[model samples]
Target: MEDRKLTVRSVERALDILLCFTRNDDLGLTEIAVQIGLHKSTVHRLLSTLEERGFVIRDAATEKYRLGMKIWELSTHLSRSDDPAILLLPAMERVRDHLGETVSLYLREGKERLRIQAVQSNQAIRRVAQVGARLPLYVGASSKVLVAFASTEEQEALLNDPEWPSWIDRVSYMEQLYEIRECGYAMSFEEREPGAAAISVPIANCHGVVTAALSVSGPVNRLSIDTLYEYAPYLMEAAHDMGLMIQ
Candidate 1:
């Protein structure tokens, strides 16, 4: 009974401390203790242990604590889950051949999306995103489709958070999301990078839940909006085929 009580309290306190960081911009031990109703000495001990484990770090100048790199390391590992990638590659290859554009696969890691695999087009010019790059889910066509299709609670949870650094205009993201749902694919023209364009379709499993997105991208000169629009049908078809394989 004593051990059970300690375990419950320990979990409650740890969750409280993590939640406390969301309320303030940056927090010191005293601030955390006051907010979480823990003693300052206890807060200090927990913070030091978290820091040693690389889950939190101290600011040199301000002496405040914030999230640490260990989170990113873990995120990278989780983003590259192999089963989806293996199933998606053949369809990506088919779409690459049909559109003659660079094709990519993306999956969500927390609130961010990571590019897990890509195949470059054999064109004279190409636009490239590295395999392991992380991008905000609120931006870019592919990421937005993934976000838009998520449960309303999950969507609001991300949008309502006060800690998001790069603020995406909420209205525009909503508009783009509507378009993605209507068209069964997402399209963007150099929104993230000027002079480039992208078209993406979300791939779903047998249950019709989106598991990943496949996108094709290239430079404006070669990949005009008209060309992208023409490719959208093919992109959706490829995604459907890939989803069947993955499911």
Candidate 2:
């Protein structure tokens, strides 16, 4: 009976740990402990166990814990769930069909940008994408859009990163972000990867939170800098449609 009671209490505490995370992507040990009214040692032990099982991940730089892809992987298929990745796939396919270029969806994952889904172009020379590919937040057009629309806190965090190029003026980049915010899209040619060009548009939640991005990509010659601008309207339209349905 004592063992049974201990098991019940453990389950309750575990549930409380999971419930401690909602809306926000990350929490530190102190924050979780204070929120759950538990000791720091207990919270650390629980988080350690959860990390071992892939229920959560710790950012090496921030030392904060966020729900892992394992949790996202499980919850994505729940009935009637309106996950943006699921919604973005079909829209991406349409963009590929419209432009005969590759289309992809991205979301900010920590300081890295994650490509969660993509539809490839039919051409032999087109850019190829893997679903789980990650890139730096400040580099590509899709990632730039995500950063531009991010909260001021997040933007500041990324801009202050030590990896920022020395030649690129921070003040100018800040101003450019404002332009991206005003125009509702971002474009790039040979910025991240040589011989590649991309055009991207933002996806905002019902709360006007800019959370994800949709982009079309192709070879630089076929989809030159000028062509990227021409494709912006189509990307914006698809992103706008998806934004309307994001709960």
Candidate 3:
């Protein structure tokens, strides 16, 4: 029992060392030791083990430690897991039930947006979101939200792509993306599909990086632009809840 307790404590200290890099990209051994209230020698030993396991890297010049590629690789696996879908479903359902509209979780796939999960409304005339459906990232509310929060290089790549729809005015769309970023949401009516309307907000991970778009959508007749605006707070709250589950 004593040995098991010691093992757990060591594991906890190692995790603390890794978490120290969350606020600053890189940290010196003394900095980590001070932050976590551990002795320098103990911190060095733990960092050495972490570096060997590929969870941290030491810069030779400054001798500061930063997160290694293995962390990013593990994160990619987590993103691909079913955990996010399962964890976020309840929040999506809450929004769907409250608004009587379909709620969808969209992840960006290159120049397209894929519906990874959805909870459809029970209404007789409701918008149906088919999971695994890939739609262009150039027209709909969710699409715009994804693009708006995407990295600058990603936005430029999509804008310069030859497949960009000719009907979309690049300058105007750029302006809209700016607005979406400033307002923290996006809305569309009869843009992607006629008679369809949607309001979407960005879903950010623990690191504050936008990972997906959460949307509430329905037929235009039932979800007019004004009604969608009123529903924004609910959708935003649900999206924030879902984001908390990403990590």
Instruction: Please report the candidate that would top TM-score against the real structure.
Output: 2
Instruction: By lDDT, rank the candidates, best first.
Output: 3, 2, 1
Tell me the lDDT of model 2 at 169: 81
* Residue clash pairs of candidate 1: none
Candidate 2 Cα errors over 4 Å, as ranges: 1-80, 163-167
lDDT string, candidate 1, 112-190, tens digits: 8888889888887788767867787766778878887778888878887775544577777678777778888887788
In TM-score terms, candidate 3 sits at: 0.67
**Residue 71 local lDDT, model 2:** 88
Q: What is the lDDT for 166 in model 2?
A: 70
Q: In model 3, which residue pairs have backbone atoms overlapping below 3 Å?
A: none
lDDT of 3 by residue, 1-247 (tens): 9999999999999999997874578999999999999999999999999999999999999999999999988967774444667788878888877888998999998888988899999999988898868888998999999999998999998998999888889899999999999988999999888899999999998778899999988899988878987888877877887787787
RMSD in order of candidates: 7.1, 8.8, 15.3
Off by over 4 Å in 1: 1-82, 165-167
lDDT for every model? Answer: 0.80, 0.84, 0.89
lDDT for model 1: 0.80
Q: Note the residue pairs that clash in candidate 2.
A: none
Residue 239 lDDT (model 2):
83
* Position 10, candidate 1: lDDT: 78
